[model samples]
Target: TPLRKWEDVERTVSLAAKELPVTDMHTHLFSADFKEQLLWGVDELLIYHYLTAEYFRYSELSYDDFWKYSKQQQAELIWQELFVKRSPVSEAASGVLTAFRRLGLDTSSRDINIYREAWKNRTASEQIDKVLAAARVKEVVMTNDPLDRSEREVWLHQGNTDTRFLGALRIDALLLNWTVASAELAAMGYQVEGEWNDGVSGEVRRFLKEWSAKVGALYIAASLPGDVRFGGRDHLTAMLEEAVIPVCLELGLPLGLMIGVRRQVNPSLKLAGDMSMKADLQLLEAVAVSHPDLQLLITVLARENQHELTVLSRKFRNITLFGCWWFLHTESMIQELTRFRTELLGFSYIPQHSDCRVLEQLINKWEHSRTVISEVLVSKYKRVYESGWLLSEEDIVRDLNEWFGGRFAVVRQNAAKTKVR
Candidate 1:
């Protein structure tokens, strides 16, 4: 079933990349059961953190006054400034246009009300299904934080009801904000103090165990700032070593680390205020070696970290590099990273994860991503084909699937098979 010509390679790779059903390995999406937590609609798309950050870049509106507006009002200003006053040329702005077109909504109207009216009759579930299907997203993993009172309330009270949603236990609080963490843990009936103790460790382990099962979490994750060092001087190191690592090791869950985020550089920007700094990639060297059996999936926000991160993944068998996160999620970065990842790592690394907060944003994110990635694939395939290699449609599809989510599954499977210690 080998394809003979360059034309076939171009044609088949494009279609396969576009049509393949992918798993979003990391997203903020909730099930329809969580109600408004499952973000969608044109308003949510317009007011996305990316667009909001860009909106404030040029808008004369003061931060306090802008925060005073309703979500719809904010979305309206964003639409007018980003879409009307200027061209919707920024990635996030153009993504709004892309999502609209993919959903079969009228982007040509340039009218926010038209998009809003189109969403009036649709249920969250309907919109989720349409969005996922449009993106060819088969499944999505959610960031579930037990220390978050609202999320924990939903988890403990009603729990997630949607079949498509899976969970990853987010331990940002456990890693960084132990004050709030211990208070939340205490309320959940786990007796722990402001410090990590034997009893406290046991309690924390118990919490992780119960909640991981409660939410069907596939892994444990935390977002750490650039200064956080894995084996060196850092406050979170002890908690990670004593609590998070052991629990993850015992439960056969891969530890997901999203590093290099420097939070609240501009408090006025809220979620958009955070920025990236070059993390000491050497920090991971010790942890990756010490816990050789445990799976470590990492993504960094700094562009400077990409080369070192990929190089370090080369040194360790257990490390799996994934995603072009945050500021690095643009199309150009995706292409650049995809090129090197393929050249150096071959197909071992995951090319991208939507990191999508809005459910409907999946449509445009993947729509744009597929186009960018497939272009890389076409060139790579041609080079290999010229080198006397021929690929069939099945081969291309399988490769695309692996880059999308199959590789992450293999990592998860390896961790699952690890004898929990």
Candidate 2:
């Protein structure tokens, strides 16, 4: 039916955005097959890096003291500090409440054990189902690291049971810290060495190819610093030029570059310790110039780099910007990013990735994202509608499809001809 009225267009956009099953291109989420590696439940949600970072902002707890406590004790401390002493109003705290309400837990009771009791009888499989359903996420790509011993054991030995989870080969360690990654690769019986040579490249490529096939990797991924560049001293640039890009071309996978991450700025915070910087855009321009056919999935962590990233996307069909990654995943950032990303790129960009580390995070992440995206769509539709373009329900659905999932497929494997096998 035609969306003749402004109200009708608003309804259409909201419904489409809400019901659309998101294709989360990057998540630290694992299937139930990962066993203990898969983090879920209320305690896990409370102690997540984001909340832990927030917990430190107000509490007088020392990093050493926090580290000494168990996950349960940490969660209880976070609950008392972040939720009880203050309001559960911060986005991270709000996410926990959102997940609780969706899971049918009585958040009004304000007790941590009540939340735990709700999750008591629920098995892993049930948790996955309920969370995915609540999030309306049809597919999620897991960050698969072959060098990580525990995850490696699961992939090579136990095997992944959930078809809903696809793999993206994480190569930051391989690219940035080759000495450490190479030693592990050598230990695993891959003939990889620290020196950069044709033989070394071939061995690294062979390892990537083997693992890409093992996990059916949809793409290769890396998180790099703002200072990343081509023709550099670092192994990162060399690995991309030699093994990473070549293997990507061979296996029909894109390189998802999550740039500008300055790892461990506050060493005490551990995973939450990282920060972002304005990456030199020339790095991407150089790679895009060199390999026109190699699809590049890009996301910039710093707000300073967003406009330049969007403009770069304009120049290269090979480059597709995705997600408001890391610090930029909040509601305001999503609103600002999605608005300009739409105004500048039209429907060419992939809107957002969940980047979720826990199972239930999918609920709050997508819920917040869908709300923000729907507003953007409605306003865009209204502008064209008032211009006598005469929008329809079909138009909103079609664009929403591309915005959420369709564009990912096109950008990911369309350039390369072969499957990873």
Candidate 3:
């Protein structure tokens, strides 16, 4: 039914969008398995990799010299150089203030130690709950790396029991950089000598199966470079065709590809210095064309690729476009991308993903994104209502719920049924 009035549509959509519980589709955050790996506090917030890149523009400190400082020292330096000495005007800098304000801390204090003292009382789990409550996050999808020794040890010994932290198997090393990943696999007692072949493919499948079953993974994911192509005779493509895709199909899970990351553009800044390039959508097109049965959760880092990717999603039923990732997570970009996606694909696309490496970041990231999402929805609904469409409150709720997490929940439930059979 169509919404009776424009005021009713605006109020309904705005309320539904703001209050909806988000199942964050992709994040680099950790579970309690490696509690130390769970980053929080004002210092961690101030020294985020995004801010690190910005720090370079204003600081006299060389990258090599800055790298030598301890974590606490680096945080202090960033607070002084970027926050106190200059205006915290950029999006990354403003985010730290946002988190602080959300936590009921006084942002007026230039003293870093005072803010640190404020965070000293809460336990990690308690802080996680606080952040989630503030962000209205229902579930957080973690990037579980099986090759990482600390994370692997947790799985081997205790196993993850937390329902809130959903697992996603990150297979970038195995799929894209097998030489390094194979060595890590060999150390874990899986046999693989030289190039990829039948035996290695079997081992890769076994690894994915064991971990996926152990962690109850919602999906298998990887980040690929701009040059990544399908239909090649190369071993990487061979591994994808033979092992990765087959394992995903067998397990009845979606494959998540975060495309166009140009890793380590500045070796000194490490992960923070990572950049993006425009990836060939033709490769994605080839993959979708080749594996029509396979479901894909795709998010590209480059803004230029957004339209083409959405167009591709329109063409292929299997591909679902998700999130404005990393550099593209700005308000302007989110507004542009969300409007473009909504107009072109309707509610078929996911509007946002947290991608937060630290827990408290969930506050600012989701806060900023939800505002953009709601604004976009309001505009779209206004147009529809003007044309005499009667959208009920139930209609708005259902669409908002599905866009947030209901669809992913359905995918997970279907995968579980497949596993049982």
Candidate 4:
């Protein structure tokens, strides 16, 4: 029977959304082997990049002075200014509160020290399990950089340290800024000089092959600037065509393009200083059109690009628009994007990617996103039910699984088969 009652529809949708296990398609999160890389606890949560950006406006401290302080000191200052001095009304500030509340902690306590001590008692692995369980995250797709010596050593020695931490090869440095990447690649004993010539292209392919095999990377990804173009005759584009795309094609891996990160607007603040700008959708369109055989997973950083991206996804079968990234991760934006995506593309697009640098963030990120997703699904399902269409519990679960992470599983399975052949 159709879910005729509003209560039935709402309950069904909410439960599906909440219980659906998520596969975080993109994140900077690491495994237990790299415990130092895992950012958790209240201090890390409070001083996250989003809050850091907001902290600057209220802070009297200059960028240089702020950088001089230790992580603990920075978190203390942020807590004092952002939470204590003023109201924690903003989305980023409130997110910390949400995390605390979800984690069975005292949100009423403004004491950072208390929270820190509580967090310190939990081991990294235990916390990861707790956070994943809380987030209902099935697997976390990690952004692995082969160029980073620390990450490289881990991959070379430990391989994949955790089953939950799936790898994605991040080729941003090699593709976007070849000058620096060439120097780094050479230091790592790769013969590529970062030129667009055959020698460099071959070395790039070799590097990709090695890393892809080592980590069984699900995809090859790169974070591009807003101004990135596809049809260009430049070195970068040439490399993309000659090496990157071909390697992905050979490996049966999709290309995950995270476009529109305007790096370091305020140089002193480093990672926190990065911002977003509206990107050239035409470039994305061109890539999708040119590579009909290639599957591309794209997420633009700017909110304005959401509708256009959805429209593009509708037009191209190979292009899958996923996530409301960084600045666009707010509930309002997620609701807007998810609603627009469902209206235009049905449930074909992936609604969210945690992009969490910290493990615990998976908790609040998914919790907030799931609530918004449920709301959108309920409204959409209600409209469909009114139109005399019936959707079963099985149908809702199927859709939720696909949206959550089942699609990713299929993609990975296909890649695995291709590798076997």
Candidate 5:
């Protein structure tokens, strides 16, 4: 797959997945080049770019241009202009399970293989068929926000666009955003509805519940940018309060938070100057205390010139943090990252630059480790915990005790046990 047109490249990977583990190692899989690869075998596609591309793309234009166009025109000219659309959920989910089985990459819970074998005693095809039949995909998928030209201009006027682009070039960016969202949802059997505004919390919840029932969405991706936190937007809180679980029930998509880090901020600086790290911790603690079953994924970039990726790896827990790059310069960092997240992290997408051999080697290794962790450990943990045998609170305490070399137990016991019955 030489660097050719985007669609061809995407096609090559998508088709390749049928035979082997097709890993598109890129900073962002939304590029046309990336999309071609996505269709074939994009099992475990890892996105590593700022989810804010859509915002910047649309914000580059003026509001006059933005509102001047109809929704269809806006969708086409702005949102549709960038990135490959996502594969449908049903198709994508099926493709992933099918490919995994075909490749004998059964990283599902250990019990999965046992149960599967005990039940079917059938051929591989039969096994995959059974898995597909029982498959319940809860994808928390979301698109980057693409602002219209007018919107971009407002941001620009407010010093937000921060980059330059031509007229309606911003619109092209918007189109790309919508294209990715629309295509992904359509593939998964859902039509794109406009964003919810002016709806009361109850109204919003009802809408999401109905929509979830219709689309069978298990979890939807809720992208909340850092700006919102600064401005007290509280999108995550609102979603949780209003329509979170209902939407989760309707679509079966658990609420996955797509947290964004500003690209302009140096990675090292972001880490070093991270007074807000505790804020993220507080957010997680809040979610854990409130939405016990919620899944929080904090997405950040590992772009070439940023910071100490390996050092940054030890930061979060129970959160899926992503570090992506466009070239292979970050191999060492990626390897070190695997050590940090061998158990905790889900994926690390580092697309190759000029060295396909290097990328192939690195990606093969990444895919292997990712498979083991995601399939083996994650599945086991979930199944055992969900079986209602071990209390989650106790499990957390035990893990924390182990983490603290058993010191935490004495402190926790004295604090909690001494306070009450």
Candidate 6:
């Protein structure tokens, strides 16, 4: 698997078991630059030096190639299905009608007659069909929002290629980015409760009820702000409560909330390229959306150190928290990375970091911790804890010792303070 053209298999295996042995087919296989090229369909010779080496019969596919091919194939399939299914606009019209009724608007004969006439006159369904047909069907998730005249055009063109392919790969879970309030999300039938400014009100509970009926599995992204009235934090607890209502009552829906994080504005790091770490931490702590069954993603950019990574790892369970570091060839790492970004960030907005090492390390550590807890501890405990399954006093000491490795311990309360000249 390591030598297979695509590293995804190797990565996937690694994620499945934290102790899985990993061997690189070639050193170049780990190179970010080469991986990028491989993604763009690079040649074998460029991928492996042995192909260019004298007297060596080069095997065509490496692990990376197979993975890349798999991606392309899956993307094409999703495109095909999306085109074939052609989700009807009548669903949307029906939803709007229902909403009108909830909002106290009459759905009587007069209103129905007017609506019927408008529906007949409007070519909304036909327009949606046309947009899907015209989509270019690129096999990549847009790095940024793309310009498309019609909403349907954007969905067809920009649907999560990465997520679709990963799901096809049969990973445990996939993270996705979305704003519940966005029109696309609404079309997907995610109900919006009370206004964000109003905190989590009865309306939010109603929205979750509607959403749960439709989506058997749910992930909600959320964040908190310092301001009590309007920020995500105020409503997040309510949101989670809403999610569990149906799940607990045996409504047949399994719900998860990937409490999203948003960076707070900070000016101290003016030259530090976005010093929003503290703000992100605040959001994580204030509205801790930790649950044993649910997968929570903590999405934040690293500030070029392991400090933030260590702190986050110590907190939160069922968390796929992403820092700036990761193993490109590990599935668990990739999955965690995606969870942090998509599941958590889908609701929360954390800016991307440019540094590779910090990002990569974040990924590795997150994968390591998640694998240990989910694969091992969660089953053993079979019950949730406010602060994760108990770590022994010895375990705590060991972790602390590791944290302060080789750093001097205090000498009997430091006897007396010495004045510095």
Deviation in angstroms for 179 in model 2? 1.1
Superposed model 1: Cα runs more than 4 Å off: 232-234
Write the residue-wise lDDT of candidate 6 on 266-377 in tens digits: 2321212122222345434443443333333344333322244334544554333433321122334434443433323231212111111111121223233334323332
Candidate 2, residue 57: the lDDT equals 93
Pick the winner on TM-score between candidates 3 and 5.
3
115-217 per-residue lDDT for model 1 (tens digits): 9998899999888888888889998999998777778779878898887899999989888888888888888789996556689888888998899889898
Ranking by lDDT: 2, 1, 3, 4, 5, 6
lDDT of 2 by residue, 1-421 (tens): 7767888889888998999888999999999999988999988999999999999999898999999999999999999999999998877789888888877777798788887987898888899999998889999899999899999999878788799989889988898888889999998898886567898889999999999989889999998898878867667778888899999998888988999999999999998899888899888999999988899999999999999999999999999999989789998999999999999999999999989998999998889999999998888887888898887888888999998999998886575664445
Best by lDDT: 2
Task: Score candidate 2 by lDDT.
Answer: 0.89
Candidate 5 lDDT at 296 equals: 35
lDDT of 4 by residue, 315-379 (tens): 98778888989888998899888998999988787889989987788888889999999999889
lDDT of 1 at 369: 82
Candidate 6's TM-score reads 0.28
TM values, all candidates:
0.98, 0.98, 0.96, 0.96, 0.33, 0.28
The TM-score measured for candidate 5 stands at: 0.33
Number of backbone-clashing residue pairs for each candidate, in the order shown: 0, 0, 7, 0, 41, 30
Clashes in predicted model 2: 0
Clashing residue pairs, candidate 2?
A: none
Q: Give candidate 3 regions above 4 Å deviation.
A: 1-5, 410-420
